[model samples]
Target: MFLEREEYAILRSHVHADSVDLVDALAATGLRWSEMAALPPRDLTLHGSRPMLRVQRAWKRIDGGKALGAPKTKRSRRTLVLSPYLVQPFKRNCAGKQPNDFVFTAPEGGAWDSGGFYHAWTRAVSTMRVGRPRSPPRPVTASPNDRVSTTSVTRPQSHDLSHTHASWLIAKKVPLPGIQARLGHESITTTVDRYGHPLAMLDDEIIEAIEWSMNPMAA
Candidate 1:
């Protein structure tokens, strides 16, 4: 599931200072976690009229360690445009790094493993109370009724941010093809199948047009 704007803000506020840029980059670009982890400074195009992130390789976990390899699919190796707001975070991340150096590295200057990234994300989200606690039917207990509490906390995987980004684009009415290209989906059908629900936002407008067509006098 995708994060709402306020929840996203809360999550961002709680990210560790060292990982702020990494989290920001994920939210901004919607790159897969592996892609983000393997991004190099050279992949960033911050100077040109169209700033973008060049997706090349991803960090893949092997038997004993990790390796940088081509993206999951050829389409996944496409370039994505960056919003102006995202440029500074990328710039901050690129500073003092060589072109070949990874843009977002671990504290020890290695590719960030999935485990470490998950830990950092958990630490950031643990601070906030996400949703209301549900009161389950009082457990049948021998003693006085103890409340069975269940809170709906939003524990989004790092990849969910990519979903969030696509949701935002869909909410803003970006075209399916554009979204497909930005997400590097090999087929427009993939993008549509994944996010077509958001297009329901047009339901009311469609209904209005149909009504107008049925009764010209109403117009």
Candidate 2:
């Protein structure tokens, strides 16, 4: 399920203060929760000519629990361009911290493990979702402008934020290969499979392009 921009805003507002920026970053960068939770201050280049975030590592599952490992795939180690909105939150997180410090952290301090972050995500959704009796569950066929119901979105996981990010970019008409790179998919096939349905919306642009090619101002 995907969330419209305003819905994302409402979700962010309800998230606990410690996690609000983490949620914002996920929607903005399309980074995996592990990739994001492991980010260190040094990975953020906030003031450069090209403001971006480097995906260097992630918390990978292990026998006992989890550990810092290389990214999920070779492509997952790529860099991501950040929009203007992300800089302030990143800067605030990086303040007075060493290069090795986690950019986003739990309320008690240090990086957020998956379980801890999941609880935070669940709490925020419940506040806006279960609390609103009049709000209807999001129908499968809702129009483009419809607001997302956190409760109705089928038990949203923190990972959905990544999907929501891609949906936002698709709405802006970004190409599939571009979204693949931003999302760090090992192959374009993975991107297409996961996003094919929503990408159908781009057929209108494809038709317009074909029309342009078939005519040269009737000259």
RMSD of each: 4.2, 6.3
Worst 10 residues of 2 by lDDT: 129-138
Q: Candidate 2: where is the Cα deviation over 4 Å?
A: 130-153
Name the weakest run of 10 consecutive residues (lDDT summed) in model 1. 130-139
Best by TM-score: 2
Candidate 1 vs. true structure, TM-score: 0.83
For candidate 2, lDDT tens digit of each residue in 55-162?
999999899889999999999999988888889999998999999989988899877878888888888887764222235656889997987655433545678789
For candidate 1, write residues 1-219 as lDDT tens digits. Answer: 777789889888988888888988888788889889989999999987899889999977789888989998988989988899989888987899999898888876677778888998888878865544445556566356554557544467778889989898888878888888888899998998888677787678779989999997985
Q: Give the TM-score comparing model 2 with the true structure, all chains together.
A: 0.86
Question: Distance from true position, residue 12, model 2, in Å?
Answer: 1.4
Q: What lDDT does model 1 reach?
A: 0.83
Error of 2 at 39 (Å): 0.4
